[model samples]
Target: MILENNDFKLDVTSEIGRLRVLLIHSPDSGLGKVVPSKAQDWLFEDIVHLDTMRTGEYDYYVKLLMYFLDPDKIKGKLADIDNPESKRAFFKPDNETFHNSGKVVEIQTLLSDILQQKDIRKKLVAAVCAIEGCTYRLQLQLIDIEPVELAKIFISGSLNDEQMIFAPIPNMIFSRDIGIAINNHMLLNKPAKKARARETLLVKYIFFNHPLFEGYRDNILEIPDTVQHFLRPGEEQEGKTTLEGGDVMMVSPQHLLIGCSERTSVSGANEAIKLLFANNVVEKVTVVKIPHKRDYMHIDTVFTQVKRNVWVLLRSLTIAEPAQDESEPIAWFADKKNKDRPEIVQFRRGKKPKTFGTLEALLDNISQKDLQSTEPTRFIYSGNDEFPFDAREQWTDSCNLLALKEGVVLGYDRNDKTVGAFQKSGFEIIKVQDLLQKFETGELNPQEMTDTLILMPSAELSRARGGFHCMSMPLMRDKVH
Candidate 1:
């Protein structure tokens, strides 16, 4: 598809807009691999059945996208490229297989070389997805081998290092966390966790090789080694520096809120802003420091903007001490006298100090009923009123909501206390199932509905430590004023 008109400007002014285009990936079998054994390692707090989750998520994308864009306007990576001929073409061999045993070494050498090249990187990544190849395989024979036997074989020089191969990436369905588009630029994230690295690879291929976005493929950005080393060192780890798009939410063209938690770090947020502003891509950002607990890893875990000056948040964290002011400081000499006289002089420093207090106090001081119109800032809440422990649980995403437009959003239908708070604040809430029915019955005009909230059930997806917004990425949004 050709973008004849550059109508979709990144300078967002509001969340409600005429839905134009969006990108989504349906949940697939990869979710099935998230078992109790590997859940924690993979950053999942709980494992869920793939079938139900996929069904629910599918309804989410289909119904949600149909509301904003032309039913045919929205696109999905898996849906667009499912043609049999296309799959055959992608997996067709470009080179002949080796006939001689020695040629195996040649093949290995070629594979290694190709893996490093930019063009071949694209091709190989495409092939991996096309072939659905697993990078690792279980060796039944090796499973029974005893430590003594393996050690003796190794000592006798009878063991080989090539026994293990590559493993398949089983988590591409959650495409939002793997790669993101900031304005017109694309940044393929290197997820700090090992289990999600394949997500980055798959996204790299789609951005580079997909015919729909071929023209802008070169806009991809990578994390610099210097920043990576500073945040996540190869040796002794002293500080945290991991960040993900799922945790970062843009409130406006100039303001961004980054969540600092177990999955993201203070340094990571700083470095990301430096890179973004240095590249002239973004002007300002607000770093919101969330607890390091596993449940509240990203900013989206607690808050999301639903409409202009409206937000649905976990009242606890948003109103707790507001995030420390992460703005850069200005340095100046207070006085230049007595340099040679050896007289005492005071040095004054100026800083954009942060407000640390209860959420009610902060809001009272700001005197702003709407959050969007306030000076670009973040708010934290005291613990939940219903249950003191709800803060930790909610921070794990008990309150996150997804905005279909400025006034519209989606959240867990059962969070009545939280939903009551939103309704009190002037939001109109609807269950996801109800909304789907509205669309089906033609009671709702998908394109005409600007700001609406469609709540999803948290009985299953929430245990995995994410809310509606965390599980989704908005490829396109209306400019928020």
Candidate 2:
């Protein structure tokens, strides 16, 4: 775990620290597989045109990342870094010559392992060959092809008319939900939805076998694969064990925040809490139970840290009349009332849920003390004292902002109210294009900026219901001051 100046480090201790490295997946042809008939089943709210997302939505996101970090430091799908020059730039240099790097060789060897394993190879080929339009003989012959090409086929996605043999992971663009980095270690999560299961598998392969991650060990939260859920009885109910990176966050080195939402189950949060405590990684854990509805699928969907002590949250979660919702608790901490069998407070559907006072309980759990100063941690609601605006903006992921550094964040430009709220707090709201232009012209430097919020294009990305935080998975970040 010793970090050399040139060696890549995998650690993230805060949300708003200066970003050092990132992992992302740009949109691919798999998005085209999402037909209107089954868009919901595929985890997509609506069918999106692959070309539009690739050229407009995804391309702009990649450009923004390249601006903050060296292109070589950003990791993504093999298709995006297919060329020799890109490969050389992306992989670690072997010697004086960059072309001799270990990336291709290591990845190929990893693919070779898949080909070498009889059961795995058969399972993979059988799945692909099963596609309605695929010829079993022709597809089976693909095994004889080179390892690199085979890997490409696997990643690029294979499909036929009726159904996708290997559905291109369109959702991979949201890397934040696939894997999470804690301190110097990696936590590989098992995605709840079948559509995103392939994403977890792909990311796991890269981290476990790729040369760049060869020396690292990952603590994986394993669950049933997509196929297993349907094939095995009671497997569908086991989804309670699912955990996603979107529902997990690092509040500080000593504290961890896990959300039990539509995407992350209470069982999953419990498992993560157990693991974090067992590893002594964190001293305390907070399990926030958000509404199970899709609009509030993940905690980040309705809440995000904007600065060191400031948070942007949905107004619906926190109340104006502070009597405490004793009927609907939105957050939970370890119940001290139960010592023999410690449990989180009762809240959620099916069973009658109870609510707790938001301000007092949240402050107590977060600060672990009675605080006199309220300005220490400010909470900004998504919309102004407006009803429809709050519901409307929250649907577009207005609260899901990603902090580049303390006081500087990134979010969707379309959320005028949310952006205005940050601006009202003395944040300099700058458009992504404006900043990109400045970076290109050498007119602005991110290292010197403070209290800024860079707005990104959201015409298409917002349609996907994600913002900067959902799009990014920080591999490393400078410790916040």
Candidate 1 per-residue C-alpha lDDT over 1-481 given as tens digits, one digit per residue, 9 for 90 to 100: 1112244332222233333444444443345555577666666666777656645444454445554454433223323322433422221122122111110011112223333445644444344434434332323332234432322221121224233233323444344566556766665565667666555554565456543454666556665534346556354253545567775655545444455666666666666766776666555555555556554555566555555544445553433222233474522321111111111111112224354343223323222422335544333221233454355446545456656665666666656566666556555677766765576567876656654556676565655556656555455565543
TM-scores for all predictions: 0.66, 0.76
- lDDT (tens digit, per residue) of candidate 2 on 1-481: 1112344667788777788776655554566776777778778887776656655455555556665665343333434453544533333221132222121122223444454445556655555545424676767766665544455456547522233455565676687998788777677787788777655665665566444565565544343334444555574684557889888887666656777888888778767766776666666666777667787788888778876667787766665343345677733321211221112342222245333455324634453331122356677778753556776888888888887777778777788887788778788888876776676666887678888888877777777777778887787888865
Give the distance in Å from residue 135's predicted Cα in candidate 1 to where it truly belongs. Answer: 8.1
The per-candidate count of clashes, in order, stands at: 35, 3
Runs in model 2 lying further than 4 Å from the true structure: 1-5, 71-139, 145-152, 159-164, 218-235, 320-356, 359-375
Candidate 1 versus truth, CA RMSD in Å, comes to 14.0
Error of 2 at 41 (Å): 0.9
| Residue 184 local lDDT, model 1 | 62
